[model samples]
Target: MVDVQGTVTDGFEPVRDAFAENFARRGERGAAVALYRDGRKVVDLWAGTKDADAPGDGPSAPWERGTAQIVRSATKGVAAAVPLLLHQRGLVDLDAPVGTYWPEFKAAGKERVLVRHLLAHRAGLPALDTPLTPAEAVDGVSGPRALAAQAPAWEPGTDHGYHAQTYSWLIGELVERITGRSAGRWIAEEIAGPLGLDLWIGLPESERHRPGRISDVEPPADPAAPGLRMRPRKAVTDAYDDPASLTRRAFAAISPAADENAPAWRAAELPASAGIATAEGLARFYASLIGDVDGHRRLFAPATLTLARTEESAGPDRVLIVNTRFGLGYMLHGPASPLLGPGSFGHPGRGGSLAFADPESGISFGYVTNGMQKNVTADPRAQALVRGVARALAG
Candidate 1:
């Protein structure tokens, strides 16, 4: 039996049970789950070995409270927050053309693309026609230049699609153009440092030893195939399976993908995909978004928070080929990735990691795993824990 450790408020023991059951039934490696309610930490639990294959017969290093994991696309939520916070501070206007801030974005007939279009995935700049090497991508050298020169896959704001890797460079460059600070640096100074969250877009060399090694798990059987809980529409499955589809191209924007666990990758700032954080860190960050955490500070005002969560796009996604919904910069609760309630908003990583805040329930949740299950939107393990959270709240 795996030994799960941490505290849960009196009524939330079910969350701990679900966390352990993930190890027994869902094959979880090192992982953690945390929750905050009304700005107070309610549940914080972690279990399993940090280095599952640690050398000899000696005991493996346990997953520690400080251990962080690379949360692939879940980083999108954090990155999105940077710009939204700036918008709240009157630094950027959502309705203004992105070219207003970054003049070069006016190239390729993209002069009218609004800042909100980028946040809501309606800019239609999903895949780059020119592929970038992993090294050039990590060094922040090629992605922005290539994207600015390429035309959109569809008319900007006419359709919505997941930008995948392109989102990092697009938003990061926007932040840099406006603030004269890289998104990572601005986040460190304004968000993470103020909140004291152990999250990083561009991790420092000194923190290199903190992240656990990530390993991929076999993907779940196709949902469109027989014996699945939910069958996808033909268009959804077709787009994902075709190598030449926009869906595939967007995800593969970085050709010969960079090694995610490498020191170089961690040290670079890929705002959309390469964020590092512990489950607690993610939960606390979300908690701050919805309300105050530890009397430290709240990131969004009520008006700005409302705008951030308002649905900007809802329909078939050109790249994902599924009916998806998005807010200003976060994934809304929907068929693609459901969180606590209709009011819940957040992003899920390409793998199993997920973090969200439910304004209705005053719940902020985060879950991270070193063992990655290949579910694009919802991972079953995280879903199970979410169910446990629902049950606890209901009781």
Candidate 2:
């Protein structure tokens, strides 16, 4: 067995072993996983190489494991929570028309759209009508400019679609408009700092060395196959091109998906994407939600956590083109969910990154990896680790 170099709290040994099994079975090059239950961490383990192409590197060395890794779309759950937190503080309202916050959003018949609609992935604007460069997408001004100028794919609030790259800009702008601080800064100061976790929306320059170099995603043999959950047409033009392509143009500079270890990418405050953290930090972030964390709660009220866990949308997604159930700011557990049972709520990244809070059983599980996989949502290997945590909780 490839020994991982992290600590596991007592009573969650099964979860530790289960993660080990998945790491070995899948030939995981680099990965980190952490779980918390009842306001306490239960499972924390990581192993393997930073890049799949360099697997001969021993997993036994503590220095071999990566740190401050990117978690991809999992950043959305954390980002969306910012507005919800503001709402609870009486600074913003979720039911109010979104245009009330950003006047330009009134263009394109989006005047009636509510803030909840954005949280639900029903605001449309899934695809840009015109091709946008990654620079345009992340340039503080360009993202909102394009969103305000573009037309919605469908009527807002009438249909659900995975916003893909647009979600971060949508919510991040709102947080900035409301709080006068970038979503990344707010999250760093309000959420991560208060919780004493190392998670980052935009990474810090000093933390760059901690992350493993990102490896290229394996390309599918056939793009037309039904096995594809996010089709080519469904993705932005910059998503992927040519076989064995390592980088997506979508993250050219300031986008959340920026280079695995670039200084600018780490410094920019993109709330919807580009979060960097350790599994321990992510688990600590969620652990605060499960209960009082040393008597300090980042969220304004406890009931807000309930709102986050409750279902908001479930049906065919306009962008993903599949049924997706979502809570206020997180992905709820469902038949198609990667997490085990309905009590789990978290987000999964396009590659192999995952984070969840199983409040019913008081469990939080997080996994971060450098290896990029073809599957977007249905990676059984991630779910298997979640299931193992569930069994440990039950036992």
Which candidate wins on TM-score?
1
List candidate 2 segments past 4 Å from native. 55-66, 209-261, 298-300
Candidate 1 local accuracy as lDDT?
A: 0.85
The segments of candidate 1 whose C-alpha lies over 4 angstroms from its true place after superposition are: 52-59, 210-234
Residue 236 of model 1: what lDDT?
Answer: 61
Instruction: Compute each candidate's TM-score over C-alphas.
Output: 0.94, 0.86
Query: Which candidate wins on lDDT?
Result: 1
With candidate 1 superimposed using the best TM-score fit, by how many Å does residue 171's alpha carbon deviate from the native? 0.6
Candidate 2 TM-score versus the reference: 0.86
